[model samples]
Target chain A: MEELKQAILNKGVVVSNGVLKVDTFLNHQIDPILIAQMGQEFVKRFNGKEITKILTIESSGIAPAFTTALELGIPFVFARKKKSLTLSSNLLSAKVHSFTKNETNEITVSKDFILEDDKILIIDDFLANGEAALGLASLVEQANATVVGIGIVIEKSFQPGREKLEQAGYQVESLARLASLENNTVRFLEEVATK
Target chain B: MEELKQAILNKGVVVSNGVLKVDTFLNHQIDPILIAQMGQEFVKRFNGKEITKILTIESSGIAPAFTTALELGIPFVFARKKKSLTLSSNLLSAKVHSFTKNETNEITVSKDFILEDDKILIIDDFLANGEAALGLASLVEQANATVVGIGIVIEKSFQPGREKLEQAGYQVESLARLASLENNTVRFLEEVATK
Candidate 1:
């Protein structure tokens, strides 16, 4: 987590008031070594939980979820952003509002992937508005699966995402929590918490 | 490779003629254990290549690329299907035609991640039309990076992808090379000499 914070500090760019860009390492261009470590950490965080499957959303959540799935030795199921011809017609759908895109889109997962009596672990790169995570949780519920935990690489604490998820009775754990992004400088709550 | 073949024969779905869907394990719902083994196989296949990075496209390609990158302890850069707010303005772009989607979309990788001197190993889930592979290759070329090898989970031999890529002089390795998929039955080519 410290390494991730340092990487964000060194390379992350604040594009606007709320947008923190860590594309140099986090999402677009992935640091696989760090991602693998993050996956291990997630495994540690949810050590006792029965994580039968990892649920993520494309296209950014794929990397971290992939690594996490490998670490946990579980199957990774990601909700496709678009419905391809290869996908089946029976799917569980949820509406996700993207803060960056400034629009809501329908996210879906095939019914065959997630089954009842399965324990799911949801992973993602960032949790901003919590729309995507909530949407994925919606799909897990549709499958009659239990969401064991929610693991995030980076979380925006100033946003209401964490509170919203907590209110929904989901245990959320984020490696890096951004406390504030003011005047083009990103600050971490963990940094202040440690001091 | 035998394990991969067995996984396909046991779990892969045979769609109509020349179409085999291994989405249950390869793409839609990914088996991370098998993917980890495949990653080791990729490292062995491209053993001597100076691979500085693992290159792939978004969505399905991210999983295998993540595994290979973890195996080699390298970074992975994925080309996005569309530009997002987080994406940088300076990018290497290429047009990719998806056979399943029946549409052509432009994929882009930000110039900041890939360097001119980088030696990239490309990885993907399937090699059907090879448009996605070629698109990633184009991004690497635009970055002035060398594509050391192309690792595919499955290759449809009936498709012209391998021929086209080999003509372009790329060292390609597929886990299972299907000789043909006739009447919804998948068959692999006979064991041949390895390059």
Candidate 2:
């Protein structure tokens, strides 16, 4: 987590009060080494319990989720944002609203992927309002699967995402927790706690 | 490569003459161990290329690309299909037409990521009409970077993708080459040749 925190401080761009752009290493442009380390960190954090599969949303969530699944030696399934023609009709879906993009997308996964006895670990790049995470959990529940926990690479602690997931009775583990992005400065939750 | 070919024959679903659904392991629901093996295979295939970075499109392309970048100890960048609010105006953009979806997407990458004198290896999940691969090559060219070659996980040999890329004067390495999908059977090019 130190490397990720350092990367955020060094390469992360604070666009505004609540927006932190980590396109250089996290989302748009990815550092595979760092991503693998974070995936290992997630594996270490969630050392216990059974995880049959790793679930995530499409695009940004695929890399970290993939790496974690690789480390865990499990399969990962990503929920597609748009329903493609190739996708089968047997699907478990949930509507998710993105605060960043300011649009609602119906994310879906094939019902054939998530089985009734499966234990799912949901992973994603960023957690702000918990809409995406909650939506993923809903998909797992629809299939009568067990929700293992939520693993996040970066969490905006100033937001209500963590609290919402905790309220929903899901364990949330975030590698990097942002305390604030005010005045063009990147602040970590641990840094603020030590003060 | 044999494992990949076997996986295709066993799990790959042929929707029609041209459409092969590999959602079971290659795309929708990903097998991480197999993906890591494919990544290592790519490293072996593109050995001594001096690749400084791995380039891929978002979603389906990220897994194999990430694993390849991890094996190569290089960074990987995925082009965003839709421009988000956080993305900057300075970008390297290209228009790619998706034949399956019957839509065109203007994929873009941050200008800060791709640089001059960078040796990039392009990776993707599927190669059909060569639109996505060509669009990716254009992005690298716009940045004045050198494209070492293109690595594809699955290539429809009967399609025009490889021919177009080869005619464009780029070396392409496809892991699994499909000769035909007629009569709902997955036929590999190697199998066809041996017969």
Candidate 3:
């Protein structure tokens, strides 16, 4: 988590409106080594939760989820952002609104992927509005699976996403929490010490 | 490779239009152990290439690419399927036509990610017509980088993707080469022996 905070300070850029972009190493251009480290951190944070499956969204969320799943030796099911020709089948779906894209789209997971007894660990790259993570949790409940906990790479503490998930009675843990981005200077909620 | 073939033969379902759906293990619901095995196989097939980076498309391609990158100790950059609100400037863009979705979309990569001296290895989940591979190659060229090779998990050898890349003078390697999918039965060109 300290490494993550340092990486955000050194490489992250906020374009406008408190939107922190760590795509340099987090989303678009991935550093799998750092991702593996974050996976270790997530594993330590949610220790002994007995995570059976990892649930993530398509595109950005796959990186950390894949690394964590590999470290945990578990399979991951990524919900499709859109029901394409290949994914037109029985699915558990929920609508999610993206504040960045300003659009609402239905995210779906195949019905065969998640069974009733599976324990799901939901991970995401960014947890801004919590729509994507909640959408994944929606599918988790639809499948009658137990929610272990939600692991987030970066969370905007100024936003209401953590509050929303907490109100919904889900355990949420983020590696890096950004307190503010006032004047393009990113500040961390908790001061992270270097190792 | 034998494990991949067995996974295909046992769990892969050949849907209509000769589309072999291995979403059960390869893409949608990903098996991390099998993916790790395939990554080691990639490390073997692409031996001594001195690949500096791995390039792949978004969503489905990230799983195998993640494992392969982690195995090879190289970073990977996934080309964004669409230009998002966060990724708005300084991008190397190329238009690609998707046969599955029947539409053309511009795939963009951040200009800051790739360098002129970077040697890239492009990997993908499936190769039918090679649009995604070619699109990634376009981005590699735009960065003034050298492409070491193209690696595919399943190449529909009946299609023209391999031929097209070979004609383009690219070293294209595939783990499992499907001969055909006649009568809803998937057959591999190279009959992989189980390990």
DockQ of each: 0.79, 0.90, 0.83
What candidate 3 gets wrong by more than 4 Å, as runs, is A192-195, B192-195
Between candidates 2 and 3, the TM-score winner:
2
Clashing residue pairs in candidate 3, if any? none
- TM-score, each model? 0.95, 0.97, 0.96
How much does each candidate deviate at the interface, measured as C-alpha RMSD after superposition?
A: 1.2, 0.7, 1.0
Question: DockQ for model 1?
Answer: 0.79
Candidate 1: tens digits of C-alpha lDDT, residues B1-195: 998998888888888766788878877888988988899999999998889999888788888888898889888888889877666489889999988778999999888878999999999988988898899899999888898989998998889999889999999999999887776677788753221
TM-score of chain A of each: 0.96, 0.97, 0.96
Report the lDDT tens digits of candidate 2 across residue range A70-176.
Answer: 89999999999978888859989999999888899999999999999999999999999999999999999999999999999999999999999999999999999
Candidate 1, B50: how far from true, in Å?
1.1
lDDT of 3 by residue, A1-195 (tens): 878888888888877656878887888888888999998988998998989999999888888888888889999989988887778888899999998889898999998988999999999998888999899999999999989999999999999999999999999999999888777788788863321
C-alpha local distance difference test of each model? 0.86, 0.92, 0.88
Which candidate model has the greater TM-score, 1 or 2?
A: 2
Off by over 4 Å in 2: A193-195, B193-195
- Per-residue lDDT of B21-131 in model 3, one digit per residue for the tens? 888898799998899888888889999888998999988888888889999988899998888877789999999898867989899999888889999999998998999
